[model samples]
Target: MENKTIILTGGGTAGHVSLNQAIIPELEKLGFRVEYIGSKEGIENELIRESHPEITYHAISSGKLRRYFSMKNFTDPFRVGAGLTQALNIIRKVKPAAIFSKGGFVSVPVAMAGRLAGVPVIIHESDVTPGLANKLAIPFADHIFTVFKETMGHVPKEKSTCTGSVIRSELLDGSAASGKELCHFDNNHKVLMVMGGSQGSALINEAVRENLDRLTKQFNIIHLCGKGNIDERLEGHEQYCQFEYVTHELPHLLHLTDLVVSRAGSNSIFEFLALKKPMLLIPLSKQKSRGDQILNANLFKSQGFAHVLEEEQLDAHSFLAAIEQLAAEEEQLIHAMTEAEPPKTAYEMAKLVAAHAK
Candidate 1:
């Protein structure tokens, strides 16, 4: 117990950092000192620094992990190599009990470095299929934890376990009164929240905005529209509220939301299920991603937790229709969520992860 230090690594997007964020306090309270390694300018830096100032944040050199042919591909490996050296130095100095990675490009070097430094490395994959970064980091991982059982086929079964989704503890503590005070919508109308993942979807945003006049007549709207995408003209509308992105306010906003229209990212949908929110999911098209969201949305639909609207067919009419359908199926969705396996708390997940520490 002399060395309680553990390093958390991930970044590039909010998705990559959320699991790490959820586990930090739990890890800290369990008597571990936390340090984070992320890119100099990645979202993880801002998220960790702003929200958990007590933890030390280490910035290392990393290049974009690309799936397509880019000129930078030639130079990125050098950056990755540099990143590995930096990570190894950090790992040796800290002598952490473990290294937990919520995989992103930033995590690849850390995982590799952890292996070279003889530290146990654990990875958490929330998608049904591992993303490129996770795929690369898997070979270096001592153990892999996944949110979906289906992900087992994609990972080394001997080292992986399906732990189900871990819902952030703060999400369950939301106050309806605080939520109501934050968004001044009429009590008579049910609130519908529209979130297009962390990066926001233009297609989803367009569909919502175009049908706003009609949609608002039935339900009050809360929109997390993504940064720099807000239309100034929509600012003063009484029945609608928009934000580029939310950090601490998310739980309250979700508490006020009776139903949700969202992208089918595993993390977001599972949070909705945990909250028992009936949702209409618009998954990003295959052209836009590796189609992980499509698989996630389809599974949720089969489980009765959501209504799926593929982006290829997304339009204002279909969007509103999906919302209407979600409302009609609200009770059924809640029932499904209630019957499903309950999610793990951040503390439980943190401990399970710590079990793999060196």
Candidate 2:
């Protein structure tokens, strides 16, 4: 088969970028050459350039579209238009067969450019509540893919498909079978892993830090602190380890964790399900355009794959208490979580993109 060239756009946060990371190898296997277009300042561009340096990289200045009201919104259109111009140039130069977007503000311009160039545009929405970029780009896209069935109702059904979420290839491998062994926790330990999505959550970190002593007594924790203002001392608890990020040992860490305390980003929630690890989700506030996080948390809770707690309700004592309560029902929770197992989202989406690519 001839190698098909494609441009992948998504970024600003890990959720958007990680999907690009997950699909690259699969796209390559199917004889598709992939390039990434993202904001130079977005997390995706940095992570992609570092991890996969050889791929084509183009940076654009696409400001975010805030939900409530912000002065930046007025000027964002000009930036988006400039980004679209750059993206059009790239598309003409690369002549990609298709464009696969992960639905971030940065994706808007690139997908628009692809549409203008008559390239097939495919977008993957990783939220229960789709973002403005996805909503605006939907009409231009040839196909739209979502991580949750709940999200499909918000989009035109004719263009939408529920394909779960595309996670990095490494994360989906041996997550269950090696959970206990690789993560250095015995069956009785009730391992706990706390992550605040890609950038971490300050509120979650603060709450966890305040109750570290109580939590560490029974649960072993691997916490990704996300550059919060919380003190590193954590009351001098020996059971907790912290990092700003975790790129290398994520799969091992998730495999070993019994329960994940996380932000309700669609990627994070789906990662837990893909790993069959129950979660204690604390979604970010809707004011932060974290409405998707809230939606994701509610869905996971209703599905019985995870428990949801609002950030405002997170105090040290209450947090610890919730952990204790959930730990007691670990077996039941894990079982409920398993019902959403073996998410082949990346593979399926890759296959679709490959088949549709010019």
TM-scores for every candidate against the unseen true structure? 0.98, 0.92
Tens-digit lDDT string for candidate 1 (114-229): 99999999999999999999999999999999999999999999999999999999999888778777777656688999999777889889999999999999888999989889
lDDT of 2: 0.79
Model 2 lDDT tens row, 152-248: 8998899888887666668756454454444444436567888877767777877877777777778877788775443555533456667678786
How does candidate 1 fare on TM-score? Answer: 0.98
- Top lDDT model: 1
What lDDT would each prediction earn against the true structure?
Answer: 0.91, 0.79
Worst window of 10 by summed lDDT in candidate 2: 178-187
The TM-score leader among the candidates is 1
